[model samples]
Target: MERSRYLQVALEAAHAAAEVIRHYYRDGVEVSIKADATPVTRADVESEEVIRRAISTAFPDHGFYGEETGSHALDAEYLWLVDPIDGTRSFVRGYPFFSTQIALMHRGEIVVGVSSAPAFEQIAWAERGQGAVLDGHACRISQVHALEDAAVSSGNLRTLAGGPRWADWAQVVQRVARIRGYGDFYHYHLLAAGRIDAVLESDVNILDIAALSLIVTEAGGVFTDLDGGPVTLETTSVLAGNPRIYAAVAELMRVPG
Candidate 1:
């Protein structure tokens, strides 16, 4: 019952943020660089504000960690992680890849999540125990067990390309039946919906993928950092897939031989 309420609030917040994003997306907005050199626009800021307001109103005591608004009461028992526009670059350039992400973390474990891509007309959500849903239908992962038979996707591999894992990643790329770079919320959506078999990323923040982690996991997929660690506030990478494919990828990532 409590999880349902949290999911409802999260979905509402995501919808509110999507409205704000769509408004600016249609009217056009200026972009500015953040301290980390990433692009930000009015849609990003305003959408985050809309989401923050919606969530805070429902759970006044819960904490918030938004990409644009910064953090508030992070140590609180309940924390909402938000990325109003996860694909700011794609959004700034008039693409349809951006989305609003919202996830509730209770005691450091994500309990509810909602990912809304207004321009793409896609919304995915999940609760800890309840199944994941894309649009209005329940979603699940693919059953492809072998890397040679799996369709793989990669996202933001800048860090991995420069690190020791590049060789291992290359080997995996060579083994996969297919490879695509549907970065941001798209690949995870595909994975959860069973349209893809695996996704790899080496550069992401909790705000960007926290909601996605829960969505994929609830859909019967495994989601963790590139090192096979659980997703946390400090997570910066991803290695997610169905049970068998996930194990194969994790092993290949560790020892390409």
Candidate 2:
């Protein structure tokens, strides 16, 4: 019920990865394409390890689900979701928007989340009742209710706007006020800060969306799959937006593949 300790540790883990990830990112990092066609890197792996060690030592009983090493279940009341270096593609290309995400979910609900974008020197986090915060300031979703006036974000145009799936993506963009391509998980934090209205993207893992879900929800936004279903570890596509436009946005992305 209390969020103090969990949020503290989550921020610590996220900041730890944030610091190390910065160094490897200076000259850019190497990338490896996964069997699923997703990209990973040494920076991503090492960052994941850093968070894993921090979490394990701080809360030995807490379970962990990481992007790199997969899942480690301790069967405890709490689960830590981690994305060591979210946006390995951007990181590999020397882009500055990638981040490290950490979250604490208790009994199936995400109660705490920490996302650190070291490149930007910003940290965004949330606790269920505490609301979402950017740095130390309270954050909220945009009041924009009309899609024609909304500012939107997506991970990558090439990845999300190409192939047969592009047809599904095109429909969503057509209805938005403007589409800005800012790849990586950092966009959700931006959405929580009220800087963006929504973020739709494909091909992700639990680690990618877990921390984001708490941040957005506590900030008065919604996080769900394209079809408006609850987000889960198995979900690869995501639709996140402020409450007013979430359902409308979700409906637009529901076209079957």
Candidate 3:
């Protein structure tokens, strides 16, 4: 695997943010509803602050787009995408699945990523051409190519039901062998670990998908938006998995004209 200084910086930032998340985890951290109706906690803000400071100190001119702090230098050639605490609901409930995700985008392409789950003591990271690692071990996606033999997961059903593609998504559920709603950062971890074949989710933000996108793809999996498009800041949905499974799911997820 190739080594990179920037990837190291991303790892350091993610680890630094993890400490803040652990401090507030299940400690009655206060939460507020954002304008988008999503929950944000003190941990989220503090964690994002930690990440921003770490990265900026290392690369002062790099842009940052964080879930809590919003965007900075959006037009800069280098952009750091941060999701301080993905699955905030799970964090508030003391669930172990929430993760801190950080990714570096160079000229609009994500080049490095880290997904650190504080409670689980697990960290997954990847750099382009460096493959991926989970908890110090090399990672790879499952080779399961057949949908009928694949275990699938999605973002919460209620969330998808309210979306325009619910009917098309349902077709995916019927085609796969098993389905679980193990939404958020954790699902990508599972996909990279070869524990599941695919994950389909809608209404995702760039911060929610950036890190996991690189991690999964580097782990020999595919990552793309719901329509089989590239995952980007404008992406509102995602369908990710091993190459074949991704193709199958994306086909099933396409809404009819």
Q: Of the candidates shown, which would achieve the greatest TM-score relative to the real structure?
A: 1
Quote the positional error of residue 189 for candidate 1 in Å.
0.4
lDDT of 2 at 158: 53
Top lDDT prediction, candidate number: 1
**What would you estimate as the lDDT of candidate 3?**
0.88
Q: Which TM-score value belongs to model 2? A: 0.87
Q: Give the deviation of candidate 3 from the true structure as CA RMSD.
A: 1.9
For candidate 1, report its TM-score: 0.97
**Higher-TM-score candidate among 2 and 3?**
3
Q: In candidate 3, residue 205 scores what lDDT? A: 85
Question: Per-residue error at 216 for model 1, in Å?
Answer: 0.4
Candidates in order, TM-scores: namely 0.97, 0.87, 0.94
lDDT of 3 by residue, 1-257 (tens): 66588988888888888889889999999889999899999999999999999998999999998888978899899999989998899999998879888999999999999899999999999998889999999999999979999999888556678877788887888889999988888889999999999988877888888889999999999887766678788987778889898888877777221
Flag regions of model 3 displaced more than 4 Å. Answer: 156-159, 255-257
Clash pairs detected, candidate 1: none
Sort by TM-score, best first: what order?
Answer: 1, 3, 2
Tens-digit per-residue lDDT, 152-187, candidate 1 = 999899999999989999889999999999999999
Tens-digit lDDT string for candidate 2 (101-170)? 8888787777888888888898888888888888888889999998888888886445566667677667
In terms of TM-score, how similar is model 3 to the real structure?
Answer: 0.94
